[model samples]
Target: MGGGCCGTLVAVHLLRQHHPAHIDMIDERIPGRGLAYSTAWDDHLLNVPAVRMSVFGSEPMHFLEWLRTHGRPDASPDCFAPRKVFGSYLQDVLNDAVRAAAGTCRFRHHYSRAARLTYDGRVARIALVDGERIQADKVVLATGNPAPFSLEPAVPGCFHSPWEPGALTGFDPDADMLLVGAGLTAVDAFLALQAQGHRGVVHCVSRRGKLPHVHTLYRTLPDSFDAAGTGGARGLLRAIRLRARAAEREGYDWRAVVDSLRPVTNDIWCGLERCEQRRILRHLKTWWDIHRHRMAPEIGARVGAAVASGRLVVHAGRLMGVEPDGSRLRVGITLRSQAPLSLSVERMINCTGSDENYRRSANPLLRSLLESGRIRVGAIGRGLETDRHGALMESDGTASGWLFTLGPPRVGGLFETTAVPEIRKQAEALASYLFSIVREPEDVPVDYFLAAGI
Candidate 1:
C-alpha cells in the first residue's frame, strides 16, 4: 500500500524472488519518498552511514556502490549521504526491479489514500477515497510513520508535524519559535529552520532535554555481553553501562559497544516479559535513542555551533500551558528543578517523532480496522500487535492470514523495525513467506495491495 522506502523494499524483494503476477502500491506521495526522505532541505543528511543503508541486507555495500556509478563517483562507504539522494536510490531500485519482472509481474500504483479495508476470510478488499475498490489475496500495511499526537486544548499556529509540506512556511523570520521534543526530530526542525533563513531563537523542550549524540569513526566490536543472563531491564542497563565503560578503557568508543548489540537487540527485546518491556520504554527509551540514533558529524557540528551562539536553547521541562496572545502564543513550562518559565512565540511545532499509538491514529483505514475488531493494540500501546512474520493479530489474538505489515507497524514486536538494515531483512523474509504460499500465475487475482499511508 505504501510507496515509501519500506514498501519499495518489500516490492523489490517480492518481484525478484517470485515475480508475483500482480502487485499494487497505494500512496499519494511519490514512491520511495516518505516523510524522512522527501525533505527539501539538503542539510537533512541520513543518520546512518552509506555502507549500512543498503535496501538489501545481503548486499551491504549496494547503496555505496550505486552512489559511485550514479553521479557521486567519489562517494565513500563512511560518508553520510543526504536523505534526498537516498530517496532517489530507493526509487531507482524499485524501478529496475519492476522492469526486470515486466513479463512475469504486473505492477501498479494508486495515487490515493486508502479509506477503509475489509476481509472475508479468503480475500481482502480495500476502498479508496476516490470511490474505487480492489480485492487482493494479501494486504501489507507499510504506511511508514504516522503523524505526531495532537496536543490537548489545541491552539492556533501549532503544527503537529514538521514534515508537513508547508508546516514551517509563513512564520515570521524574526519571531521566536518553540519546538516540542528535543530528539532527532527537533534536531531536524532546527537545522531546517536554519536552511530556511530563519533568524529567530528556537527553543526545544523535552522531559530530559537530551540531544542525539554525534557519529564518529569507530570500529564495530564483537558481541560480548550475555543478554540471556541479564535478568531484567535494570540488569540490562547495568550490563550495558559496564560494557560501555570497559570498551572506553580499552581505547574503543562506546558506540562500538552499542553497535555490537544491533544483531541481537530483537532477541533480547522479545525475551523480556511484558512488564520488563514497559519498564524499558518508560525509563530507558530516551537515553537509548540518543545514543543509538545519532546525528551525522556534520549535522552535529552545525547544532553545536547554534548552541554556542545561543540561537538554540534546550530545556528539560514539561509544558504547563499554552494560550493565545494576539498574534503569538504564550507557552508556559515548568523547568526541571527550576521556576516556571513563559515565552511568546510565533509558532510551535510537534517534533516528538512518530505516534506509534494506533488506537488513536487519525488514519481512516486503521480506525475502521480497530472499530471492526480486526486489529488490536500492541505491547505498551507502541504499535499494533503482530506475530513474528508481521501478521496482524486480531482482537481475539489470532494472527490474520491475509493482513500483514512491516517497518514501523511491526515496532511493538520488533524493537528495531524502523531502520533499513532491520526493515530490509523483514521485507526479504516477508516476501519469501508470501512466495511460499502464492498461487500459480493463472489463478492469481491481485496478489497483494500495499496501502501506504493515512
Candidate 2:
C-alpha cells in the first residue's frame, strides 16, 4: 500500500514477472522517491555502493548498467552516487516496467495518504484521508520508516523531524544551530547547512556522540565465520573479534570481516533469544550501527573537515530539555560524566532517528489496525509482528494470508530489513511467494472458500 523504494521494487518485480494482477501504488508524496531519496541536495550520496543496490536479485549489475546508460559511463560499481540520481533511476525503471506491462497488467498510482485499513472475511479495504476507498484481494504494508521520536514537546522553535520539507528553510545562514542526534540524519542536516554556506557554529549531541564509521576501499573477505558455532551475542561478538584480529594480522582491513557478516546477520540474529536481543539492543546496537551503517568516504571527509575547522561540535550528552528563548532556543544538555549545561542556538533540529514503537506512531492506519486486532506489535516492540516470509501476524495468534509487509515493518522479525540490498531481496521473495499462491480473479473471496470447507 506504499510507493516507497521497497514498495516500488516489489511492484516492479511483479510487473516484470508478468503477474496477472492490477497493482495499486498509494503514497502521499512522490512515488519511488521515499524519505531516503527525496532529498534535493547533490551532496547526499547513497551509503551503499551502486553495485549492490540493484532491485533485481539475479541482475546484480542492473543499477550500474543503468548508470552507464544515463550519462555516467565513468561511474564505477563501488561509487557512492548521489541519492537523487538513484531516485531518478528507480523512477525510470518503474516507468519502463509500466511500458513493458502493456495491456497485460495495470498499475494505478494514488497520490494520497491511506488513513485506515480494514479486512473482512473477503477483501481488504483501504480508506484514504480524502475519503476514497480501494478494495484489494491482498494488501502489502510497505510504509517504510516512521517519523523521528519527539524527544521534547513541540515548541515554536523546536524541529522534531529534519526531513520535513522546508524544515531548514528560512533559517539564517549565519545563525548557530543545534542538532539532537549525531547519526546519518544528523550528518545529512550538517551537510545541508554546509551546502547553504552556513558559517555559524553547529553542535550535535547524542548519548555516545559517535558518528557513523567511514567506508573504506577494500575487498570483501570470504564467508568462513561459522555463526552456528557461536551460541549467542557474546559468542558472536567473540567470533567476530577473533576474525577481525586475524584479518588485521593477515594485512586485510577489518571491514572485510564485518562485511562478510552481512550474509549471516539474519541467522545470527535469529539464533539469539528475546532477552539476548534486548541486551544487544541496549548495549551493542549503537556500536553495531556505527560500524554497519558507515558513511561514504567523501561524506566522511567533509564531516572531518568541518570538525577539524571547529565549525561542527559533537557532544556526548543527553538532551534534558529545550525551552524557547525569544528568537532562539535554550538547549539543556547533560554530557556524559559531567554537569548539565545550557546553550542558546538560533535553531534546533531533531535527527534522533525513526521511532520504532507502533503505539507511539501518529499514523492513523497503524493505530486503526492495532485497535481492531488485525495486527499485533512485535515481540521486541520495535515493529509489527511478521513471520519469516514477511506475512503480518494477527492479534488472534495467526498469520494473515491477505496482508503482508516489508522494510522497516519487519525489523523486529528481520534485524536487517531497512537497507536496499535486504529490502530488494525481500521484495523479490515476496513477489515470488505471491505468484505461487495465485488464483482466478473471481475466486478471491475467502468467505466462499470457508463456506465450501475447502
Candidate 3:
C-alpha cells in the first residue's frame, strides 16, 4: 500500500491476475499515499496528464472512466490534478483489483520502514523497522525514488535531507527559502509552501537554471518499434537515433517521441554495456527525463505564474551548510562566489527525487545484497541491473530466481518504468514470466462486470 507508484500498480495486477500468491505490502508511510501521493496538501500536483494515468494500456480510458463515473466527466484530460486525487485513484484501482480477483489472493499489510532483506537458498526474508520478519516465496524490491544526495559542507546549519517532515513544521513562509537543485522536487516544495500559506522569497540553486519542459500538444507516433531485432548497445543506439531524427523531421511532439521509444526502451537499455550506460546518465539523463516525462500544461502554467509574479527566484550554485535560528532556519549556499552566502527561511523541504547514491544507503537488505554481489549498481550510479525477464542480477552476475525488482529500481534496465502505462506492462510481464516456468492454469481475462462477480 505504500504510495510508490510502481508498487501499487503491480499489486493491483497481481490480485487481478488470479495468482494464488498471498500478498504483503510493507512501507513506512501511508499505504496508498506513497511519497508522491501522501501529501494531503492541495498544491502539489501530478506531472502526468490525467488521460495517461490509466491502470494499463489495454484500458486506455480507465482513469477517464473513473472520472466520468465519479462526477468529473468534464475534467480536462491534459490537466494535472492534485496528487492526493491520484492517490485516491490508486486506492480505487486496488479495490477494483481485489474485487476482480474473486478471492484468489490475500494480502498482509505492514506500516514500517523495511530495514533490510535477507535470503537463504529457498525463501527470502524482509526485516522491518518495527522488529518483525516476513518470509515469502518471492521478494520484490519496490523501494521507489529516494531524496537527492546532499552536499558536504563544513558548517552545521546546512540541512541536507528532505524526507524529515519536522523540517517544515510551523514553517514561516515569510522567511527567505533557499532551495537546492531546481527540478521537480524544487517545484513541489515551492507549490507546497504556497498551499501552506508560505509567503517567503524562494531561492532555487542548482547547476543549471533550466526548468523541465512542459508536455506540448499530443501527437501520436507510429508504432514502429522492433523489440526483437535490437541488440548490443551500439546497435540499439543506432536504431533509436535514426528513429528520433525521423521523429523530429516528422514534426513529432514530446508525447510522440516517448510513445515511439516505449516499445524499445528496455531492449535499448539492456544493450548498453556498463560503461555506455554511465555515459548516457552523465550526459543525456537530465535532457532525456525533462523531455520524455513532461509536465501538464496546466501545472506548467502555474509554475510559470509563480516565477513571473516575483514570488520565486532561481540561482545556480550548491548548498554549503544550514544553520538554525530558533524556529527559523538559515541555509548557507555557495553562489557566484568563493564564499558562502547565508540565506534564512522558515522552512526547507527536500524535493530532490530518489536516492541514486547507493553506498550511502543504510537499508540493511540492500546493503546485504550489494555486499553479497547479488545486486550491483549499473554504470549510471543509479538503478539496479536486470535481465529481459525483469530478473535482478546481483553484483556477482547471478540472477535471483525468487527475487525481483518491479519499477524505477530497474531504471538501469528500463529507463521509463515508473509511470502506470509502463508499469502495467511490467506487472503483466512478470506474471506471465512467472507462470511460464511451469505449466499454469488458464487465466480468465479480468474484464466485464460479471467477471468481477460484483
Instruction: Give the per-residue lDDT of model 1 (tens digit) for 1-454.
Output: 7889888888999889645467888988888999889988899999999999999878899999999998999998899999999999999999999999988888888898788889877678888888877778888888888779887668887888787667677678999999999988999999888888899999999999998999999977766556768878999999999988989998889999888888889899989999999999999999999999999999999999988999999999998888899999999999997779999999889899988888889888788888898988886788889988888999999998888889998876878989989889999999888777666655644343333210
In the range 1-454, model 3's lDDT, one tens digit per residue, is 2336666776776777786756778876655677677776776777777788777778777787787777677877776677788778888887787677757877656777777777676556777789977666666677776446655542333445544555444565577776676777777777766777878777787655557777677678868466456555456556667777887788875457566777767567767677777767776676666666565676678778878987888766666666667766677777765556677776555555677766666656677778877787755667777877778887778787867777777775667777767777887787667655522323322231132232
Go through the candidates in order and give each one's C-alpha lDDT: 0.87, 0.86, 0.68
Looking at model 1, residue 54 earns an lDDT score of 92
* Tens-digit per-residue lDDT, 32-145, candidate 2: 889888889999999999999887778999999999999899989899989998888888889999889967887888899898888777777888888877777778898889
Q: Model 3 misses residue 280 by how many Å?
A: 2.6
**TM per model?**
0.96, 0.96, 0.82
Q: What is the lDDT for 39 in model 1?
A: 84
Clashing pairs in 1: 1-450, 1-451, 1-452, 2-451, 2-452
RMSD of 1: 2.9
Report clash pairs, candidate 2: none
Weakest lDDT window of 10 consecutive positions for candidate 2: 445-454
